[model samples]
Target: MAQETDAPQAPPSAPTAPARALLPLILPAVVVGVTASLVFVGVSVAAERLQQVLWGPLPDALGVGRYSVLWMFAMLTATGLAVGLVVWKAPGHAGADPATFGLNSPVMAPAVVPGLVLATGLMLAGGPSLGPENPVIAVNVGLAAWLGARLLPRTPGALWPVLAESATIGALFGTPVAAALVISEALAGRPMRGRLWDNVFAPLAAGACGAMTTTLVAHPAFDLGLPPMSHHPHAKDLLTALVISSAAALLGMGAVHAFPYVHAAFRRLRHPMLMIPAGGVVLGALGALGGRLTLFKGLSEVGELARRPEGWSAGQFAAMAVVKLTALLVAASCGFRGGRIFPAVFIGTAVGLCAHALVPAVHPAVGVATGVLGMLLAITRQAWVSLFTAAVLVASPSVLALLCIASLPAWLLVTGRAQMQLREDGTPVR
Candidate 1:
């Protein structure tokens, strides 16, 4: 990776810093900047290749349990290897784990950005089941810091780091709104205090970056998946929306709360590095037990669940929900580095299915639409983003309509409760 300095985007005339100050910042910036772009891109490409590796004909020679034991082993080995590489060569690679990034209190060594990106990509390509979101944010901050430091080449502060981080987050994640909120929360830099100016520009920069990234990445073929989640107003629909959103809010909260503890417990393994592969064993077992109903068909499961017939009973869907949720949590904790996006979709789909059972007359898709609307809003803590994510998942205006209505209440409920519990995750809405 050809890394430049920490100069974010300097004007033609910026004063030179003392040689002493400039030297330290440049190396880290170059290493971090180029390394991050390389590793993250590698992971994205590797994700496509991983499918072939898992189900290829050679699996028979490897073993019968390719998707089960072998896959898990591969994931674990990959994660361990990545950790080993970083530990041996780039000691500062794993400074901020997932939760730390989520909370925005990251120890970003922008100087070591390349090492961090490589480490993160290695972890993800191996299948730790964590989201791409964390890596993206890490790179965002790392690059931001590197750029800021290089440009000024003098007295450097965290202001550019914060803006660059936020903006990059916005551009890359396609969730600029969330990136903005994250920056605003992090500005306090303390436990809980808000700075006025930091609050304003953080989102602006992040959102702008996010918008730009989305535009660049999406382009003309921005298929964005499904149609928007909208619905016609109705009294009955409104009633169902309330119940579904409230339940989803509670479930979302419960899930987030249990996650840290769940992660801390089982992941405490004898071979600390092999935790993910060990987790793969558990995940494979769960999938096998759940049957094809909860297998790693990727987002295929989402499509099937969405098209579920009307009057789908809760009993049939319950096991699927438990299995999928367990798989997601374990896969993540065990180190299958993927996004929570699809898992959230599954959770919302099940919630919709169950809620639909309560109102059998309504389409299952409609119920699912509503459930997803709530689920997305609950976790993201951003309604527009939630609405947009859910809307892009299906092929019907009806579902989109229901999503808009359902998401409104869901956002209000989730965002309110999150205001309290999320202080631990780094967002304290003042």
Candidate 2:
């Protein structure tokens, strides 16, 4: 079925040594990092202001009491409609669908940036259960790639995507190390002419700069204010972590299994205008049932759950976890532009808190970490990144060993299982 070429084939260009390729990228990498951080800060600021308007003054003006379930429903519906409009009208189809793409998808064309930003801003302000990680990464990568082409035109084309993704990850997590782990894991087992670290050098520089800049500007906080595990770990703690982490992985897998069916259902609706607002209605109902704490991407909400585990009963925590998971499924499946990782983390926190409540002997910090590790492993299917996130977020250096031990059981549970990502054909792609 293939046609043969009649003309002579062009010879491949000579490869540049890794060191020579990286040398000119040093300054350009820094500039890209700074740009990505500033862009993220701007988006965050805008979303915060929108949140205030929707949750604060708008409610007062409308005379709806704070925390009114009806207001939550209305706002989410409006948000869905707003996003539907953007998706309907945006250039380049507003880039790739999040369901069909990974964190490191090719950079989108520059024309799609406006629609992407607006849809993401609306989703965040409207209190979708998804987070800014996916959309923001796309935005930064597209912009960074475009800029890098102009300023460093001679840089290897492959390196531009790496720089953009590195900067975005660093900005998102506020850590160069997170970017390093992610990139290293992504590149593992791939055939390369040079050492893996050699290719990573430029991206790492960009990531470090991005992390520093975002920290200085946004002060993005990941630590949950739980009491540290100051005492030495007991054998019982290891047992507790294994049980909790495995259980959490199983819980996360339940959502993963349901993902393809739910995504198909949404796609069956066949139009963004019909599908997105309907999804929003469902999210609003879930919020009404689960309360304000269950709304939004679970960044601050997860921390709140950890900080005040005593405030919720086991049944209440269970409800929050389930509702949050359902919301994530609906938002991601029904054309929302965001990442599932943050909401999954929130669900894990709720599950862990519930486990701790049931068995009072386990330390809350350990419970939370194991739960995070398991859920992240199941959802992302990346062990190193999950392990790093579990250890880093707790901010307790002493528990790293315990978390490392905890992750093995979770990995066993999740290995060769379903993944959360979908293929271009609208089916889950594990």
Best by lDDT: 2
Tens-place lDDT digits, model 2, residues 245-353: 9998998898889988998888898888988988899888988988998888888888878778788888888888889888998898899888877888898888888
Number of clashing residue pairs in every model?
34, 0
Off by over 4 Å in 1: 1-42, 57-90, 103-105, 110-119, 126-128, 154-156, 172-231, 267-271, 291-304, 307-316, 332-342, 357-360, 363-366, 377-388, 391-430
Indicate the worst ten consecutive residues by lDDT in candidate 2.
13-22
> How far in Å is the alpha carbon of 16 misplaced in model 1?
31
Model 2 CA RMSD to the hidden true structure, in angstroms: 7.3
What are the RMSDs of all candidates, in order? 11.3, 7.3
In terms of lDDT, model 1 sits at 0.54
Candidate 1 C-alpha lDDT tens digits along 1-430: 9987886785454334445643454443333333333433455556546644644544667666656654555544545555545634564534443432242435477656666556555654444334455556566666656565776656356655555455544544444565555555554455422334424443454455445555555431212243233556467766776677667666765666566665665446634355545665665566556654464423555666555544346876666766676766675454333445546667777876776676675555556656666665655554554565555555456656566666666666666453212233444332
